[model samples]
Target: MDDLTGGGAPDSTGAPLLDVFMQGTTFFDMVLTGLPSQPVPGTEIHAEGMGSCPGGIANLAIAASRLGLRTGLASTFGDDVYGDFLWRTLEQEGVDLTRSQRVADWHSPVTVSLAVHRDRAMVTHAHSSPVPLAGLVSDTPITRIGFVSLDEEPEPWVSRAKAKGAKLFGDVGWDPSGRWAPEELTGLGDLHAFLPNSTEAMAYTRTEDPRAALMSLAELVPVVVVTCGGQGSIGIDSLTSEEEWVPSLPVNAVDATGAGDVFDAAFILGTLREWPLRNRMAFGNLCAALSVQQVGGSLAAPGWGDLADWLAGVRHAAAAGSRSAAVLANSYGFVADELPSHPAVSLRRAVATIARMSDA
Candidate 1:
């Protein structure tokens, strides 16, 4: 097992088992916001907001870590400047990358996201050497759960991880081939949960209705969640044969880059905490909604501090006992109590709120 203290720094050796072990790619994302208009051949337009951070799997890992989940990320990083920055950023977010590989002389993956009023256009460039999923799975520590994508086969490692008592959660990307065949989920029966967007689920299951897609997918996995942007999310817990829906929170979006990934991270955290299916969906939706209000993918992901502040603000606003307040308090009862605070966390929340207001 790799050392938990990445740099050999002294810390608690009795720390809990990794809550969510993940295998995927990480990127250094450059965020350019307030682009007055899309770029033209020779037009030069400066952005009002600029920021950079680690993205992709880093979004999921850092989001989970910020939500108080102990996370481990397994992937290859380059030995370049972007790599250094990304590595440091993930470390600062408290993600364990001890099992991650670093390639010499390789440039880290990078993405330039141009934010244009609640939407974005991203251009990404990755090294020719693809992320070795097989190697990452082999390097994962025995954790409560593991996360991966279905872009590759989950063969021996996924099954092996399950046999060792780790729950496997999976996600999928859009298929340009339009094959979207159900057979693509051949060996995924071992997955504890499968979270796919509405379009992906409908396409894969060949069902026009999201509910039908959820029910059909529940037969293949223990848990199936279909995220419907704006409309909300629908999920079914096969073990209990219970189905639930959670509406998306109302929020002004600035950039919707990694909202889905942040939702996945929040779901993983809720699952680890043994929250009810409804609570999990609502929490996940809240986290994703909060993410889009910020700029960069990873930077936009809300931490526990953000969650606390949001809940506090919601509670304080709901003090008048309005119907909406009553409903929100009842739904988020799990987080209604007081929470610990720190100076850094407060500062982060203050800055994020100011940015969102300015963006509006």
Candidate 2:
């Protein structure tokens, strides 16, 4: 009965069914080095090389591919080094990029991350908007898509997706204060979930109590999840359903970049698998948990088995004691003691050689 698909996947009783499609957005990431200490005033810190990866769609596509989905990435990038890498990465990950485009004269957006104390701060510049607003919808294989996710965009496609029988989720990474209000976003779109962490929620709601803040969004959508570091997350699913708290897994954070995006991918994966709502939050939490254990954004995400092992008490526990930093510190100390003398120096040498080869 739908324009997208004949009856658009109706059941024997002529009701709708959920058949999802996974797609990725494109972003560029630059990884830099810095010690996790307060920078001395006016002092230039020693530096490291830039490591680039495909983010947003590319990043999520990698995860989806690993999960055995027929994933696709729909975005535009330039015919530069980053674009080449993006294409290769998607193909290697088994995602369909036939519909993905490379435009002339446009530069893929770039984000630079400064790593400090196992965390990072980023500065981003979109050389140009890679995908225009008009290019959001596609006719190819639209009927199979059970859900559509948009990050930071809440317009025309939101209503279109709803019409196509796709569940929708929107992520607000960050925004300039008052760039848009919470109600404005909530009103602008019909969403199943609105994913914004505590910091963003506080800014959007101007409320410190995360529960109250998450509840505020539920007035519009059926669910709202607000992620916090140690405090975990607050979620609400129904009008009469109680708000729930989802805890983060313990990790030895190498860099905090892309944790939220990984959470987005995991949430999608969980939802597709028909996971219980609490487990969906748990899966998202676990995905971020795996991401922070290593360096950079897309580079750090764990395969599903790795995440499952960690949660099953089969791995990572020895490294993430009491889910505490002390555990990570202790684990690092033990590993260091077993290594050859000057382990960090040797590790750096090995890495530098590889970087030079890759850049060559």
Candidate 3:
């Protein structure tokens, strides 16, 4: 990859052809846990667990890296203590930071999350804005798949990346404006896949039905997927006029943060392996469910061992000829026959690494 850091061309250091190059915000997240209830004014609440680590797109990059994908990140960071922590954490995770920038006199974005019950509430402050997309992709070698948001106007960089044969994957955030303007999707016409939650897709398309939303978005992009939290996800391919729906896997969720990002990473993995769209959504759902059963967003992401264990259970059920298991087998057939026995990092090691990074 072309070196955006001016250090040199990115060394082979096991870096693949920029499998997933993400451009977005990165946060330094400080987590507080074991709270009995929400805090009141002038009250002191303590937690059993407290630590910090990288957040935002770093979650996605870490999730993809754990899944054994070659990942690169392009975003700006403040030249502060928090930025130093984030940089060290990501580098230890083996993520490529050649495209990242550290700006002077700025404070890195930070989020303080309070964990209650099975969810969390977060407060964030960002002191530095992201580097423009054009500058990020200017002379750098584009990854096979480039991820960006369509929340704003179509940027010239989208077409520039596509011109170099990179497939674009588009996602969006909540429209606080509530206008949910359709023109916001104007950039998707040049994208290869559009992935959004049911609410965002429905609101943007002005349709309450998920299938309708999927089909509507399919008109603008070749591939459209609408993730419906518990109802599962819906996908359609305009090229073949094919549609698929995958039900969500049942799991006791401890934290739903970063589940969507993990799902995106897994779905992109499926796409890279040429798995059928149905399987992609199923895999995404399974991985997302596994993630929610843990704490924190990025920290909760599953590793290869987690996936293998889950697959082992599914295969055991499939061996008993269970109907639901049979259906899952059809979708996850690759796992039984092709998945590796070990993960790049085991859960124990991942946790230990997080602990180390948090303390740093």
The local distance difference test score of each candidate is 0.76, 0.58, 0.76
TM-score of each: 0.85, 0.74, 0.84
Query: Could you tell me the TM-score of candidate 2?
Result: 0.74
Model 1, residue 297: distance off in Å is 1.3
lDDT of 1 by residue, 1-360 (tens): 122222223224333367678877788888888888789887788888777777888888887777767787877789987777777668767888776778887888888889897777888898654546566554326677888788766645556667779999998876769888777776567689999999898988899999998989888889989999888899998776678999988888877878888999888877766777987898889899999888778778887677777887778778966678667877887864323343326312112221322422
Runs in model 2 deviating more than 4 A are 1-25, 37-42, 47-50, 130-133, 136-157, 177-180, 187-189, 239-242, 308-360
Q: What overall lDDT, based on C-alpha atoms, would model 2 receive against the true structure?
A: 0.58
Return the lDDT, model 2, position 184.
48
lDDT of 3 by residue, 1-360 (tens): 122112223534433467778778888877776678778899998876565667888888888877777788877788888777788778867678877788788788888878777567788877546455446545544577888888865556557768988888989987878999988888888888999998899999999888899888887899998999888999987765668988897677655677889899888888877777887888889889998776667867887778878877877898998888777767777766546543345542223123444554
Q: Name the lDDT value of residue 31 in candidate 2.
A: 65
lDDT of 2 by residue, 1-360 (tens): 112112245444333332334444577776665554545788867654445666655665665545444554557777876677666656755566545678777777777777777666777787655567347434433423323443344445446656866676666655656454655464424667778878777777778777777877677677688888766677887743756787666567766777786777667665655555676677677678777766656656666455434434532555455455454344223222222232121001102111323542
Identify the runs in model 3 with alpha carbons over 4 angstroms from their true place: 1-16, 31-51, 114-120, 130-134, 153-156, 316-331, 341-344, 347-360
Model 3 root-mean-square deviation:
4.7
- Candidate 1 vs candidate 2: which has greater TM-score? 1
| TM-score leaderboard ranking | 1, 3, 2
